[model samples]
Target: MKKKIINGFLQILGIMIVGAIIGYSVGKIAGDSLSKVDTPNIILLLIAGVVVFILQVIIHEAGHLVFGLLSGYKFISFRVFDFKIIKDENGKLKIRYERLAGTGGQCLMRAPEYVEGKFKYRLYLLGGVIFNIIFSIVSWLILPSYYTLLFALIGFVLAFLNLIPMGFNDGMTFYHASKDETTRFILHLQLEYIYYQSIGKNLLIEKPEIVEKINSLEITNTNYLTDALEFIKLDGLEYFFEFDALYNESRKLYIERDDLLPVYKVELMALLVKLISLVNPEDELLEELMNDKSLKVRLKQNNPQTKNILATYENGVKLDDEKALNLINEARKIKNKAPNLYIQNLEMKYCDYLENNIIK
Candidate 1:
């Protein structure tokens, strides 16, 4: 509790400090620009601000893509807002629409092999910050116009926001990478986990060593990325058909960790619902989860896993075998549209599990 309080305090304090710096810089730049030119059009300036902000977000993610490729990382996806360009299972780049809460953009890459206890990560992690700083400097010094000043101001603020180690920002992830070897190793494993999924590599059967490493690791770090590591471990357990252990671990994580990313919370809850349905159909937690709006939203998504979980709930808990069977069929068909081979495999397996084992 004390550690959380101190960390929270530090995060708030850091944000305030950066806010002050940005405020002062913006004032100075705006004053200087206004003194040199006539009154600027407010409507035009607002439009320009919006355009510049979107462009900066693209540049930021592009920085990660550039630096990651240079560091031997392979591209997986690049997304800005809701638009994404992803390397599909066919090894072709295709446009898709997806968005996560809180982030404006993302650049995902397949990690290089972890050789000799090290892999290139520093430049890739700091690439966005570097690009933002460079662009801001250029806007402020070379292009001395009001619009350019606005661009500089926004870029400068974005750079500092990401540079500070708070929340789920790149700064915090980089901080862990720089200071903790375990975190770095976890990151490598996590990235490799995704890479394997993209290629339809089953970690349980084909990459048992990876699953063993995941099972061996203790969740010693408080980082969300570490939480992600733990998440895949639970996933591996499910794939290995370790139901009892998966139940206990999933329950413990669900009950104890309230600070999980929303997506993780929903995923874990879905897992729990399946477990509870198989074990004790009338479990109170099942009712609670069923009533949860977030869970409902997740179930409504067009993903196969969601349909499978709902199938399990219907079959095991509600004794609606017909509905459950229909859901299983739907899940199987939906698996064809899964984002990657890994997910497609899991979805198919889960649908089979529901049909053969869970449903009466």
Candidate 2:
């Protein structure tokens, strides 16, 4: 808690220093321009810039605070001037600020709890954008000309930019919230390309056999299917199902393929594991899958079916002791080959579950 508070304070302080420097520069420029025609007070212009900076930050962040709270999000912290950091108990963080250019501003709200479900997520995403647009229009109509016009313009620009729906910006948040299948599929493809490039592999050459197999299947618009297959391979089949539900027609193609049975069966088993885990932790099906060495080894392959199996088993253990034992057995089978510190942590958790719950 102390660390977070300190970090927030430093972030705000940094923004203040940057804002002040920019404000001073703008003040000097405006002051110089007006020197001949009545020489407007440099001090006054600087003060106005500071005021604008403060107001922009307040209104921008206020949009996030008001709308976020109104939309069922619990209020975290609200601050103005420099960078504003807000966080709920769930560790979700939102940061707000005005650009030094003084044209407009932004409030970025992150809600981890906001994941899943389309409509509620969309509201959480659009909350800040909506606030800025409404506030900008209201300011234009009611506030005095000088400051009001500036604020309105700032609001308009920021709101417009945020609605773009790309990258790490607010638009991406809106897109994800919408759960638009096409957009997600495309984004997944792009991310995959980046991932392969990062790993120094040419995706085309690296998976010629898989690509050839996909082509031989005579899939229409093979790019989409290929990408979908690849994503399933990398992330897991659950995400494939997520994408498939959006593009329901794709399911027909998968159903017709005899060679795809292994993948499909694995996915089915994974889904069943998930369902059983939800009903009871001591589900026999989950235990069977966990105890099977072949299933555990297959999971290490990082295939879509394997990923879903692991994920299902993990979620299942959270709900029941029988499931946890099953998951522990599964973990023990391939403990040496499991990837990353996360898997190591899972191993520890399974051992703890066995010791404290299974024996008892």
What tens digits encode model 1's per-residue C-alpha lDDT throughout 1-360?
688789889978887887787878677757865688766799999999999999888888988988898999999878898677878778987675554656899888888888745778898888998898888778777767788877877787788878888777789889987767778887777777777777777555676686677667666666778888768768778777787888888888998998897778987888899888876776677888889998887677766777777888888888889999998888887675565667778779778776887434
Q: lDDT of all the models against the reference?
A: 0.80, 0.47
Minimal lDDT window, size 10, model 2: 96-105
Instruction: Evaluate candidate 1 by giving its C-alpha RMSD to the native, one decimal.
Output: 3.3
Give the per-residue Cα lDDT of candidate 2 at 170: 62
Q: Please give the distance, in angstroms, between residue 154's alpha carbon in candidate 1 and its true position after superposition.
A: 2.6
**TM-score of each model, paired residue for residue:** 0.83, 0.33
Give the total clashing residue pairs for model 2: 3
Instruction: Highest lDDT: give the candidate number.
Output: 1
| Pairs of residues clashing in candidate 2 | 165-171, 281-320, 281-323
| Model 2 spans > 4 angstroms off | 1-50, 77-119, 181-360
| Candidate 1: residue 19 Cα off by (Å) | 2.1
